[model samples]
Target: MLFPLFFMLMFPVECLTDLIEPITGGVCGIMTPEQYSEDLYMEDEILSSVSLSIKESGLNDVSIAPGYGRLLTMLATVSKAGSILEIGALGGYSGVCLARGMKEGGRLISLELKEDNAALARRNLELAGFGRGTEYMVGPALDSLKQLESRGERFDFFLIDADKENYPVYLEYAIRLAKPGAIIAGDNTLLRGRTLNPDKNGPSVLAMRKFNDMIATDERLISTMLPAYDGLALAVVK
Candidate 1:
């Protein structure tokens, strides 16, 4: 859980801290994580501005951190995605990142639980000049995901940042809705190191662990986990 703004940044499978105060961790060649964030994390006035809005609006401050945001953008761009699906839209911080990577006519569909949060994210995305290409489906995320599945809609990229408890379910749906060569990325999968804690057998932790396990073991996808802020799991759907 961490931020360019971290909760439900894909849909985190829980409150994976997208908007928590930036912490210094992770390792680079020479610079410290704090130094890397201060120096390497690209600066985007729009994202910075949106982050401020979410913080002031009393919304979940656990927005995805700028580091993860940049990574999402790069991944989306590298994948040359035409359609991106985001499981959770919190303040549109990650949405903007994902959309920035889309090919010229790419589309982005975001699922959010609360009306207010969705409204806010919609507004922010519009502000980011993604109005025409962005769509929002509000209500329980599972319901919207099911609707998408029923409609036979598929995506080139999938971001799972919602409820940790439902992450496995979400991953199943993602696999079901994915196109060949699609990319599936998840956040807070490390559950702030809880997954590695043998002492923590809590339900959410267990679920997150399962999420990681599925990604790691599923033969349909090739995946890896990055031990940075919280943790990041990235997979390529085969």
Candidate 2:
């Protein structure tokens, strides 16, 4: 029981890291993991600015990995997403990244459970120049999703990074909330690579396996899972 809980919280089940084996581990070509991260962050002004805010605000453990932040920003920018929904708003780290890639006049709705975290995200988002285009909701994410559904809200892109146990349910809701071309990207799909080995079965692992299988098998979604930090599941609504 303890192991499962630890596994779930050990990494952001919301968004996985970029797949670099380790700083001293084998190569993914010629670059080390640390080097890859450095290259990606070299001229990344948006992340640099947001990271400074995160440090100053003491949102230390809340943001996504820098490499993953760049990936999220690229997904949003390349998709030209007009509306974005993020299931977790950890100090607004991922929110800032997602918002930076939004089309002009785009809006981002970030849902966080803790009011204090929500407040912190609001501040960080403001510092990142996304205060006007983002809304922070404080509540159980499922309740917030219901409210959004009631409001007839739809999104072009989704970033799921909340509880590991609820990932599949969130995937269901995300599919319902997405437009045809919408993209549903989930973090920590690898569950620390436990999803690949059945012997390592645990609640979180089982749940993630179910979620990944759903994405892969669902006829409505065309999906692929990338081997990033842990894993990233990208599914497009067909």
Candidate 3:
């Protein structure tokens, strides 16, 4: 009886997509509470294994973390990014998400300094059926990015998640290699929410604050920082 009632309620399931505006109140926010709850209903076993691997490797604390993974995927999908560049590929968790969102024939190039982490990321990408769409380059992001530039590679989307102190330099490189209308996203801009306090003296926090200030005043791009995991700064090149 309950199943019949539920089926009747959802008989016109196609209508839900059209109702998104009313359901979400036309606000540009992350997944709603309902959506989040629904996400918890479906679990990807490979993703679970990837998370466990990061934890077992003792790098969970310093890695991209969980919620940010979903955010990256959303960005790639919304932007319809066909060529993506990720400055950091900690354990491949985020890479999996980003790769999954790539348009058909799209590709993602991820940079990582640690061989072990890169290997793990490669495995994770393969597990997610994104092995062909994703490439892991082992080296400092700055060096790798320079090589990409030298090769005349331009990306439709850029994700910066490398060493915080080098964000300004990374931002410059990202801008240079990004095509007009490309989207650039930076992770950890909030530095654990310390960006608002101004009392933190750590180099990462300070660098993030300075980078934020620099981009905020730049005329070439329109940017905004979203209070997501840690924080995410997104800019669209004009």
CA-lDDT, candidates in order: 0.86, 0.84, 0.82
lDDT, candidate 3, 22-52, per-residue tens: 6542234457653574468554787788878
Which 10 consecutive positions of candidate 3 have the poorest summed lDDT?
Answer: 20-29
RMSD of 2: 9.7
Give per-residue lDDT, candidate 2, residue 145: 97
> Can you list the residue pairs that collide in candidate 3?
none
- The TM-scores, one per candidate, come to 0.85, 0.81, 0.79
Candidate with the greatest lDDT versus the true structure: 1
List model 1 lDDT by residue over 110-192, tens digit each: 99988888888889999999978999999888999889989999999998998789999999899999999999989888877
2 or 3, greater by TM-score: 2
How displaced is residue 187 in candidate 2, in Å?
A: 0.7
